[model samples]
Target: MKKFFKLVGFASFIGILYYGFITYPKLDLISGFSAKSIASGHFIDHRSMEMIEKGDNDIKMIDLATNTIDENGQFATASVYGLKERKAIYREGLGATLIDADFDISAPYEVPKRTKLVSDKLFPYGNQEAKDTVFSSVDYAKLNAAVSNAFDSTDKKDKRTRSVIVIHKDRIIAEKYDTGFDKDSKILGWSMTKSITATIFGILEKQGKYDIYKPAPIVEWQKDKRKNITTNDLLHMNSGLEWEENYSTICDATKMLFQAENMGRVQLEKPSVFEPNTHWNYSSGTTNLLSYILRNQFKTHQEYLDFWYSALIDKIGMKSMVVETDMAGNFVGSSYSWATTRDWSKFGLLYLHKGNWNGEQLFDAGWAEYVAGPTKGSKGDYGAHFWLNAGGKFPDVPRDMFYCSGFQGQMVAIIPSMDLVIVRMGLKENPEFDFNGFLRGVIGSLKR
Candidate 1:
């Protein structure tokens, strides 16, 4: 009897250590990512349980979670071994928000009224069907073959491409969607949302309402070592704020996105590690800080909330977009945004045409030039909130090529030399899909 009790005490000690060091953080990540993905997949994307499970939640750790969908209450909760509990609630016009006791689910949420767009014209700019027009430079068979080849992956990466759209000269030349997804299906762009937030800053910069060169207006940083950090530094991912972006485990990013009540304020507490613009470290937290700065730009919270939709997103034609906010009701600018592939292409189009939508100039041309230039310390691989090929990341692709890239191979490659914007959104990434070859094939099919 004495031996058995001693053995039990030893096992209990091991269990406590294991739960504290490993299970706590891992379970938070699994529960958090699963809960958010399930709620958004169900409510915003309108995906079925089978599709949601097969696509987003089927990952190893996240798969261990048991989810409960409360359709009537409009929330989804995920529990991993009944240890870590996470919940995400869906809101009309606001998409899905991960919630805790501090977040008021019953509070009144208001969405900006969308201005009517003239969609009587054909697509590429309107909702009408695209007119069939033969282009002198386009190789019809090659373009068709290129798009078709993407749907059938030869490698083991399980390409799971949901949608692909190729636009040249502001006209969609090729488009495709996988099973259970169509032209109107809203897709999560993941970290591609960073580019969208940067575009909002561009609009403000164009209007002279904001300046990227100035120091980030965080009240907490005003008297500290972080006081010198500029918006340009954050835009270029060189804000020098300490951050860890590991998605496979709980880190600053997952904690900010899932555990914190106010995500934008999370980075405000990080101690400065390097001087601004001196070291390039990618951080989702930095973007949320920028979102925090954006909130202070307007007098009322309602105006700031309405401006993202009215000024940029809805103002253009991305009617399908929903940028989910945190529990504190601030846009999770670092992540969580949904839009149809074509609407994502329209965003590429907005940049392709230098912020001009058909005839309307949404922002100044200088903003385009600013986003294309390589950041000071990014080894020519990054620009202002956009990824660049200046370092030949895609060897054959143009050095001037820049893009909005997200996890799991979501890309919006814009090549000024080719006058093209190629949007490829999928579930699997490189080492299997041959990203460079795919781009070469598409570009080769249209090269003059």
Candidate 2:
């Protein structure tokens, strides 16, 4: 009788441990990431599960979840041990968003129609091929070797540098992709989406449609001390909002992204921990709040969505660009955006030329200056929505170089002094691939 009671008690303890601590948190985390990542990979990027699964499931513990695609329904489902299943549905213009049981389909949304390119001229202007040209100052042999070094996999993460594009003086000096991937393949920009969102605000400010120095226009903050937070503060990621960015557990970041309906409201509801501009902490919630502010700028829903494409995306020829949204129909501007490598290069070039595409100025040099300018309390390693080298984060890189960086080694590095823009996209981050060393090699291989 004593042995039976002990065995029963031990069994109950094991059940609670498995379901509560491990299974539940993982289900919450991987469900959203798996559903959304798989849906976008299959539907937007047009990748097979074999290709997507290799990268998506490579993460630690994330390998436990199983993903299924619903081609007819245009959605994907993810489950762990067949418990608490989560689904992400793909929408025509909005991209993929995770849906809860109460997810509303009746809500009306106005998405922008992409204008087809009719011209055949070369890129940065049209969809035609660029004529090959060789610059005398470039060391072709050394440059090729440098780009090749990114693929020399010494470890598992090292095997994942799927794409690399180097542009010097408005020309494609070198570009390469791993097997099963190509120039046309669309990869998720991850947090690189933040810089894109900030760039939109820069364009609006250039046209006198918005202001960054004023208090953030969130209505919820208007009645309290949080009202003092400005758009610039949000961009600089120093809003001091109480947030937990942990993803390994069911913290604020995972809960808001996977469980919450309105992503924007999650940050707005949090209490302020420090006065605006007094602290610097990176927050995905800050960028989503920035996206929310963008939504309220216009009177109608269509205008807000249209402006992102008409004014910036399509105008510059990023035809592959698509910014995904959350259940509340707000651009998941913090983390979800996908585009081809060549298209992403154009975004860096816009800033490289100080926002002038061909002959037309999209934003201005002032916006670039503001973006590259280091934010206070960031120790010179950060700027408004962009990461900076002013603190010499990349010692071999120039002080003026600022770049858009994302999770797992995704980068769009621009060095105006070097007339260089290097885009590197991969399934792994840091230590696995030495960013500083790669930059040193590429930069050293070229001379003006």
Candidate 3:
């Protein structure tokens, strides 16, 4: 009898140890995992990818509201809503699970289309061969040396930069990439997708598919006074919606990216933080809402995918552009888009030439100017979706340069005055680096 009791006690101890430490933490990593590495962008994890590789069984859940899993989860009462504090209860080591994971859905019934190309799409608009002929008057060797020296002076965090291409006067004079990542490896774009999403809106507007000037077409907006908010306000981040963009805690961005089924709907459900178009707080919620709008306007998510591929990506000669959508069938437009480093450079080139590609006017010329044009809030910077490389009222920078910047050091800087485009991507927090000083050095190395 003494031996039997001892054996039972030992077995119970081992069981408790396994459940408390190993299993609990592993489940935690799966359910509440958040890391921003080159591999998974922000909220996605390696385990999720592994599950997909092994036939995608890990992300299975049911939507109680719609009697479906694809819409949300089994206990969901709403389909699209913001990240409110949810009380969790772990069942058999499932880890911090939401109290309910279902939601109502009055999905928008519409279709997206590509309209006429804007005229400004032709800026920085010529081929390298044509440029060489036109600028036979300029020297390039000195220019390449300047760009190389500038990169050398700055600090590097990831060391994964496989290549750097410097385009001056519409020609590629200096180009270099790391050993493994040639022109083909599709690199991640992160928040750079915001700019791309904005561009798509431009296309949709020109086609008469959507109107930016009118109030937002959200169904909920019709139920409340929020209908007064215009699409223009949303694009400029003046939607006045209350959203916490914090990443460290399980804030709005975290919940939308990790917990919610549809990112756009989450923003729509949140109350107004301020009046629309009165102030700019820089919320990813705005972009997420745009993604939701886009999804609703298209017949299927795949149709929008095809539209972007044919209308923009393919025309720009971009071979690498992978956009990821959430389980709710909304594109993660504010984040989680990847393209090769060279492809990123190509986008810069496209912007530099306005919106024209190989003599084809892809964007309206006026719209291109509108994007690079000055805005009231950004102070000579941040036109439409692009960031103007200006010192603004404070004058932090010396020259006229603009860029499309993203989280953890993803940058695509375009200097119109110097006719240069610089692309950099890696995994690093906001380190101390003088972008203006770096530009000055590049100019110093190249100027005659």
Candidate 4:
């Protein structure tokens, strides 16, 4: 009897080992794709290396082999436990696309017919060329010290600030970058892509292509309880979709990002866990689902891409911005966008100016207000996709300020009261940076 029990225990152990062997490849592929995408999108080698090392230390149950630059040196490929390799490549206009072991790489989106290429002309804020008159009311010494404090590291915390850009009254007053980074470096915005996605929805609404108050046009939901989910509910992150956003495990987020061919399909398959608009859960699945709806509105991928560029990025002078697509050609709108610090600041400026650029209204009237307005479901901490400062969440900062927040301490804060846009990008774990204090210091330094 004892021998029989021992045999059963040994068999269970073997099953566990086999399961680990099979699943480890998927985890490794996720890491490889993440590192390679950052490398190719940003055009940085050392940063990619640093990302891989950090990922290894962060996620358990995986072994990453050496990541190598492709023969052309424009892309990167990596393997897991010396098998099940994955590669990430950068397209010309689109950002990084990961090709994993099981992914069916789709044909590139066709270029649009109305491809009026905007010239990369030098603007006032381009290359940090600000007018002297713009700084006439500013305290240069105090502002410099405030910016310096953002980069300072202490024994208890690491700032790890890669770049900082301060725009006051539509002019770049101060700009700084780490040793290897510069104005042209394409830094990933992480979850801040959600704000860009929301902006796209606003544009579509202006063109009569979508309506936020109406029911979301998802075919699968037509016969189910999810059919009641409105576009506004999804934007407010009250979609009632059952999703696990955990990155530490092989959950919905990892599957949608690394394994799924169609991100939208994966999200749509989720069962409704609660009545729409009753509960508030921060789900990336809802954002990707929104991306799916946005894609289907246009006839083809070209029309979609063209609409985004002509309607938003080009008009705002965000020349370096790139929004990446998934394996199935759906924009990973929940998390993948890259742009320079200056370009990011320009995005903030657009919102600060109430969606008008140079006297032209790109977004509909009240669009910016709607985005910054607090969602009733989120307890006043969130808007459509933008994080709000309502309810005095940041006691030091103004109650009206709103911002695009992202993973790893990426922020593009907009203060309408101060006519200011502050951009800060960084990569840090266990961040000890005080955002409210930083904003207060910057505001206090102003000589207005």
What is the C-alpha lDDT profile of model 1 across 38-96, one tens digit per residue?
A: 99999998887668888888687778888888999998999888988889988887788
- The predictions' CA RMSDs to the true structure, in order, are 3.2, 2.6, 10.7, 4.7
Top candidate on lDDT is 2
Writing each residue's lDDT as its tens digit, candidate 2 over 55-158 gives 85677756767889989999998887787788899998889899999987667766777875557878757888788869988998888888888874554455
Give the alpha carbon lDDT tens digit for every residue of 324-434 in model 3: 655454567887677767668778877777777677766766666667765556666576667775535214343456678786557777776667777766433234444
The per-model lDDT (C-alpha) reads 0.85, 0.87, 0.57, 0.76
Report the number of backbone clashes for model 4. 0
Per-residue alpha-carbon lDDT of model 4 for 14-102, expressed as tens digits? 99999877776475555555445544544532355555444322334433444666546456666655565667766666656776666
* Candidate with more favorable, higher lDDT: 3 or 4: 4
TM-score winner between candidates 2 and 4: 2
TM-score of each prediction: 0.93, 0.94, 0.68, 0.86
How many pairs in model 2 have backbone atoms within 3 A of each other, for residues 3 or more apart or on separate chains, i.e. clashes? Answer: 1
* Candidate 4 lDDT score relative to the true structure: 0.76
Model 4 root mean square deviation, Cα atoms: 4.7
Position 215, candidate 1: lDDT: 84
Model 4 / residue 284 / CA error / Å? 1.4
- The clash count for each model shown is 0, 1, 45, 0
Please list the residue runs of candidate 4 whose C-alpha ends up more than 4 Å from where it truly belongs after superposition.
1-26, 38-65, 102-128, 134-137, 153-157, 429-431
Error in Å for residue 65 of model 3: 33
